[model samples]
Target: MPNIFTQNLGETPRQALNWRLGYAILCFGLMGASRGIDEGLISGTVQQKAFISKYRLNDPLLSESERANLLGNITAMVQIGSIGGALLAFLITDKIGRLWATRQLCLIWIAGIIIFITSNGRIGQVYAGRFIAGLGIGQTAVVAPTYLAEISPRAIRGLCICAFSGSVYLGIMLSYFSSWGSALHISSHSQNQWIVPTSLHLMFAGIILLLSIGVHESPRFLASKGKKEEATATMSKIRNLPEDHPYVQTEMLDIFEQVEREKEATMGLGWIGPLKELFMTPSNRYRIMLGLMSQLLAQWSGANSITIYAPTFFAMLGTTGQSEKLFATAIFGVVKLVASLVCALFLVDMLGRKRALTYGIILQFLSMLYVAIYLAIVPEITEHFQPMGNAKRAGTAAIVAIYISGVGWALGWNSIQYLINAEIFPLRVRALGSSMVMCFHFANQYGNSKAVPSMLLETAMKPQGTFFFFAAVTLLGLIWMWFFLPETAGKSLEAMDEMFNLPWYVIGRKGAALTASAGHAENYMRDDVEKVIQHEVSHDEQVTSSEK
Candidate 1:
């Protein structure tokens, strides 16, 4: 209707939400929703194990080792598919536009869902469905964050990028609650046991595919492909402004100049350009390496471990009944979902990245330590089957500790990793860079997901040892994050290179503090943008003089 973009350009980008930005968020959020739904379905497996067993996945005729292996494969199938899918996304994200790649992934997700709906408990069919769906999940992981990052204005980019993670946690909570609800009414042996949970994934995937049809292609992608006019038009449309709008013009010029500089820097490198730019450049490599490390540690933050095995974790908290386990797991999911939403919307941009991470990790370590200590003290009452006197109190404390741990995880590692992945890299290699990081993420998640079950049953350390192990890992993660993680809130994507190129000592401060000390970082960014545009202007003038 009326031009909201014109009025908003005068306001801070963070405070303004034009129709285009709203549209972008809506599209990206839907993609995030599907991811959340898929995660909920997969993690629902913890509750659906009996359904899986009824399907003969854990057939008694098979040897114990055979059953364990099959069960392990089924659990890890999505992660395995995700790993492969990330590799594929890495190779093709730049070739096809982000929108196109996402469209393709939606199709894969739909196909996977159809396979699951019709599998009829055939193990091969079940694995095939998960694996196929995983391919879509893997690609979505890279593309969605990258898309949101590219489209968002720097002032609100952290919050916008965080929508992806927030929606994911929302989906996880939805799955937990929905599965718990279904568990109350349906028999474990009923055909609906698996069908109801798996159907949610199909419904979400279909919604994502339908919504994606209206999404505009990323302006950065268009510019990178040498379509300047189209890139400018897309940027204007996305910003809800005319092409001549000063804000739109400035934004377009900045992107073009940065893209040009990248091209000049990597001239003659040919097909290996993006890869070389990512790893061979010292600053870029460090940023990506840190991103990879963050992702790896994020998986180990014990959040995914809890989500995938919340029912088991509840059992250890002195809740043995199936209904009790489901109810507890659902509550844990609710805590995480609430914490994640609050942190994503308020804390991420408010506390700045480093402080949020530090505080979150600190609390996380304490929560895990509480678990380890409680379990170590009461080793006799294994699996919450018998809680006598102090044991009952200890179990109650452990359950509370689990809820606190979910809150800690939601506030910090869960949302921060994706934001870092989106913000750290440049346009040329952003897709490849993000894909590489996510590959490590999915791999570690797969390992942790598989390891949790084995840690509880097979390890000599038992469940007590597993809690101790995670607590120890959480401590290490805390140290690693404090030293290596930089505060990146409010910095533009184009300015990342200059920002990272600064000394490590300076990079450690809060983004606002850094900006204050740097004589207004926005001015610095504007100056840099002007210099690039000026260079092009002077070169044209010189050519004209020479010809005359």
Candidate 2:
């Protein structure tokens, strides 16, 4: 419970605890549950593989590729559901507040799980539930960090949000453990291979349901809509800090100023008119382009391809020890969790979001390079392992490498991309903009899930070639990001609009007038972040800080 660093930072005691607990529950729990259910390789594929062997369907369906596509369809279905939830963000997010929205999402996820388990293990029901669960997952993806960014002390907001990212990768690793459990033939359904994992997911989803209700909503949402008393009450409860605290007043007043501007810009038409206006404006168009592209690029990185196919790829290399593979995957999860903490704890506020993203792209470049080598040049070595028993270690090593890519993922893949989306858009269109990106993101994800599985199944034999293709793509994405995407570090929506080429109607009083009167967003956000070693904020001294 004691640390050498934060031990004497001169910060309030409960303040740190407040941030950590909120993060552990809201961000961490969301990541753990959402991705936990998402790793189709965990329960679905293992189960399907088992069925193929059991029913003698393997002879026909084992190599059919359609079977895997079926599984990918299920994966895509969840994203499809997320697109729907994101689309609804404008109407629902602030109204319900971040905490409530996430809880509602958790409940939706639970319903899907219940349907999945109660249907006598029907694949159709499973897919249907996936669609529902995906919707919840998508909402959490948008809402969790949105709230974290809103309510967090500006000094450590990025770390809090990134924690959510760490939790997601951890969840994926957690899901993979289910497959390992199945492979170990432990519990009731290991005889069938995937049944244990399926039950395991339902159990986890149930736990998430219980956890969801305990979380508090974002105080920012409450204040933004003129719910002053409620906002104060929520902040008090969440921070366990009194309304008189300097930090609480700073947050509330900040929200008050932004909301005052936004209320003046309110167009009676609600989401419809403004949704059209956002894209119609030139500057908004540029912002939207970058936001959507960031998300699209994240998906194109083939993150899922590496994640879902790790076990199967390991198998092709002849890795037979189910237990070891699971442990390796778990280790990868721990790495991601630890790395995220490091970033949240020290690096984020120091290096800045733009730098963090650049760092992630660089990591992806290196990891994917290794992946390419294994795929293109390793075929001869794989053949040497021939049998599963003989090749298990090589296969497991391959999977471990795949998890290395997961480590980079914790850095920028999901959280960074989403952070950009969340940061760039003005409050007026935040949910809508995020939803639009999610929709596009899902559309892209659908293509990757479909294409990559088929690609790997056909080409995994060539170690270098397969990885080289992805590596090249990742490098290209890096270049594209550097040239096209502008830095968003610390600038609020209105200022970012100015940085882009946004028309006044989007972030200015003109945009405010288009909807209501007060500007819907602020322009500057200077976090009281410490320097690399430590820096103090002076009451009268001007401080310069960068943002994502």
Clashes of each: 1, 31
Top-lDDT candidate index: 1
Whole-model lDDT values for every prediction: 0.76, 0.59
TM-score of 1: 0.90
Model 1 bad stretches (over 4 Å): 1-16, 57-68, 380-385, 503-521, 524-548
Query: For model 1, how does the per-residue alpha-carbon lDDT over 474-548 read when each residue is reduced to its tens digit?
Result: 888888877777778767677667767767655544433555323122443454445545554775697699899
Residue lDDT tens for model 2, 472-515 = 76787777666666555444333444455534234322232232
Q: Give TM-scores for every candidate, taking all chains together and pairing residue i with residue i.
A: 0.90, 0.79
Clash tally for model 2: 31
